[model samples]
Target: MDLRQLRYFVAVAETRHFGRAAERLHMAQSPLSQAIRQLESQVGATLFERTTRRVDLTPAGTSLLEDARRILAGVEDARRRVEQVAAGTEGVVTVGATDLAAYRLLPRLA
Candidate 1:
């Protein structure tokens, strides 16, 4: 439903074990499991088929996995772009120079 929950879902989906997913996320297992449950409830579908040994994605989970990954990647890209702008490292730079000056100077700058 949210980024955090989606992240949690991806972790569990990738690892196929709640404990391992929790370890990968550096959180306690209980909260990770709760988050996955909450995510499933919010989505109105059972996302994972869980057994004592491992977890497997249901059809709905498989469908969401791809979208969740794309959404997270987009969020990260936006965050990076925002940081670049904040740091004055983003956008275009235009320089004006005479033809000869550009021929002489641009190579050295490059």
Candidate 2:
């Protein structure tokens, strides 16, 4: 559904352990469980098959994992592109100056 839910789902799916995912996400386990439940309800499918000893992905979960990864990657790419545009760069930059000027300005630029 929403990006947050997809993110949480991806975290859980990757780790295959709710507790560890919660720790990695820096949140409590209970809320993470709830969010996953809500996500399942929204999608009308069970994403994981949980046992006392292990967690496994259902067929739907596997499919969602691929899609979620693509969506997240696209989101990150978009953000970086926006940053580059706002920075007044379009994939390239060139600076020309005398050797002495370049050496002198490098430190200040840094």
Q: At residue 5, what lDDT does model 1 achieve?
A: 96
Q: Could you tally the backbone clashes for each prediction?
A: 0, 0
Off by over 4 Å in 1: 92-110
- Model 2 lDDT at residue 93: 70
Model 2, stretches more than 4 Å misplaced? 91-110
Which tens-of-lDDT digit does each residue in 12-69 have in candidate 1?
A: 9999999999999999999999999999999999999998887999999999999999
**Where does the lowest 10-residue lDDT sum fall in candidate 1?**
91-100
lDDT of all predictions: 0.94, 0.92
